[model samples]
Target: MGRYACVVRPSISLVVPVFNEEENLAHAVAVAGRALAEFTSQYEVILVDDASTDRTPEIIRGLTATDPHIRTLRHDRNQKLGGTLRDGFAAASMDLVLYMDADLPFDPREIGRAISAMEVTRADMIAAYRYDRTGEGLRRAIYSYVYNGIIGVLFGWPHRDINFAFKLMRREILEAVELRSEGSLISAELITKTKNLGFTVQQIGLDYFPRTRGRSTLSSLGVIGKIFRELIVLYPEMRHPRRRSPQPAVRPAEDRAPI
Candidate 1:
């Protein structure tokens, strides 16, 4: 923590999306809360539960009662990653918003470094890329590499990791853009729109930690199918996104003759 003593410590809303994460939610929130307290006193952890059928809801109730900094949002039914994040981001009311997985894919203490990076770079968003992901297994590593390369080529926005679950952004960035993906493509959608809208985005490298509790499902066939479906439907809109405000219309050529 001493190394992060210079962190700017902006008020942050940590948005975690969980579904059937009874094994990880409680411990994850507690750990994240402790890490957040290290740098900033003004912070809140919003756990958006996508109608988990396990004991997760019970655990969330217990956590909310025990931790004042913890709050939660519930969905009547599962909404996958994108919808869950959209609701969570909408609920965030802080200067900064951080999106991480309930499984705690990376060290929460690294959050301070991200804040410091944001401050140093003056970027509107700080997206983290895994320094090394071979820990997750070779298959996942290959999948991620191919996915990132394809995204970079298609979107013309090359990034180290577009779908990694570590994105720190300013509240204004969320307010300025409308995110519409209901699946894994949401991350790509977010980064693309942020860049398209003329916001500075910076990336930092962090040690990756694969989930040790519960099964990993984001790479399932169904989830990957949904990602492609959303990408196809949203491609045009993302490429030619409407500006937040209408640009000044150029006067007719004759009207500018005196210039």
Candidate 2:
């Protein structure tokens, strides 16, 4: 009888978008690296620096030089979270692609569970919802409730956390969706579009923690207003009666390669 070997079939590419997150970059990289190591043998971490006017780019470059599994992309100007994520997704080359905040609000270890769910349920995407959101301010809490409600009402998908950063999905799903939001509403846009495109989604609960380093950009009223405006403008185009069918964007094969 021949001995059988278990091969790790699914590799992961994790994207961490950093904007003025110099303080958290090292810790985030370490924790995320350890988490990825626990699950897969083949993985890469792509750090996207969105033109931060701080030492973020320098730190990312140092980390990338030290770790061959770590790669980076930089924007000439601050493009916000949406643009960073788009760039990271486009540069990912693996069976699975995952992204989360550089602040490490959610535990990176939960990534293993997400990967397991993806394999078991065969879901196209798995998003993490914050179970304990007390660390976030009351106003932010209220905004999240209202925003999620609005998304549910408008898009008809009752996802718990539309803006949570811990999203894991197959590479094909990223290839299938044409994401355009360049602001805070990118998370909502991604989830909404994924559902509209007939992709299966799974949600898991994870604990949330307050950032120990830099200030959060999410609590501002300006951001809330922008999200409202985006929702209003995108509602009509996204509400087509027959939009449940998949409408994947076509792109050149080389465009999907990692940078």
CA-lDDT, candidates in order: 0.87, 0.79
Could you give me the TM-score of model 1 versus the true structure? 0.92
Q: What does candidate 2's lDDT look like per residue over 135-252, in tens digits?
A: 7778778888988898898777688988888899878778777776777888887887777767779998988887988979866887777777777777665554233236445344
TM values, all candidates: 0.92, 0.88
Candidate of highest lDDT: 1
Which is the leading candidate under TM-score?
A: 1
Candidate 2, residue 46: Cα displacement in angstroms equals 1.1
RMSD of candidate 1 to true structure, Å: 6.8
Model 2 spans > 4 angstroms off = 1-9, 240-259
Candidate 1, after superposition: displacement of residue 155 in Å? 1.4
lDDT of 2: 0.79
Candidate 1 lDDT by residue in tens digits, 145-195: 998998899889799999999999988788778889999999999999988
Error of 2 at 206 (Å): 0.5
